[model samples]
Target: MTETSKNLIAEYYALHLGELRAFVAKCTGSPADSEDMVQTIFLRLLQTDKMISAVTLPCLVYSAARNIVADYWRHRKSVERHETYVKSHCDCGTDSGPASVYAPAEIMQLLERGMARLSPKSRRIYTMSVVGGMRVSEISDTLGVAYKSVENRLGAARKEMRRYMSRMLA
Candidate 1:
């Protein structure tokens, strides 16, 4: 903020830019990413008053750079892992797929039959829980039923649906 602080930070940047860039590049394995990270670290230094007042400027800079690169890698790895999971789980219509056994129309008909077989109360509870995305507690409150009663009804509904679906599929 002050002239002295600005000058000191400017001098530190001039002296350490190359070393910082090299260290970040080695860690990140990408020149462009390393350059960007180095700039981010210096920007952080400018924003953080404690960093500007630190006794060892180079040490602080290198430490901040390392931390930033480490965070970048951590974030990148997390994103890569999530992408892998999404790619594997997404329904892209491969031959070996969850829908391979039953056509969508057949499954829908079976589901309708199964739902029809449930008692009216059970069907309402099941629809509220599954189709309506209502939690058991919310359903209980809305229906003025006990929580355990709602759970029991939902369970019975699921069992009936499972039995009906099994018979239809077979």
Candidate 2:
């Protein structure tokens, strides 16, 4: 920046540092957060070529600090909310958790082989119920079959696949 701009900013810093410190400290409630925020308010002036009016420097600097404080609280609140959700709702157990219950590629390979062994009609019904996310009643209506036939096929398909996955996985 030009020397003129740098000197102008330095003068503003000299005049406003204490007020900015107090304002930010009051806004955030933490001395450490205020220190960073006070520095940020001054540094933001470095990006601008225009000078703050001597008549309005307090309004200008305080407004910038207010915006920074708002953003800090907003980000902190989001992080706190995410941490709370994870603490209450997630079970991400240690290494032995459901997170590692399956090796994904291995499981997929076993599933593909088991599916290959199913009779085509059973496979179609199972695919509709599982992969296509269709209910048994929906599958029955779409395929013009009785709902009981759809349920039996779905049950048998699930039983066979479970047995196949267990035998292969074990």
Instruction: Give the top-scoring candidate (TM-score).
Output: 1
Query: Which segments of candidate 2 are over 4 A away from where they belong?
Result: 91-170
C-alpha RMSD values across all candidates: 14.2, 18.7
| Cα misplacement distance, residue 77 of candidate 1 (Å) | 1.1
Q: Which has the greatest lDDT?
A: 1
Write model 2 residue lDDT over 12-116, tens digit each, in one string.
888868877887898889888898878877787776566666566567777788888887898789779966864554344655566645667877888889988
lDDT of each: 0.81, 0.80
Deviation in angstroms for 147 in model 1? 36
Error of 1 at 168 (Å): 26
Q: Per-residue alpha-carbon lDDT of model 1 for 1-45, expressed as tens digits?
A: 666767888988898789889989998999999888888888877
- The number of clashing residue pairs in model 1 is 0
Ten-residue stretch with the least lDDT total in model 2: 86-95
Write down the TM-score for model 1: 0.51
Off by over 4 Å in 1: 51-54, 91-170
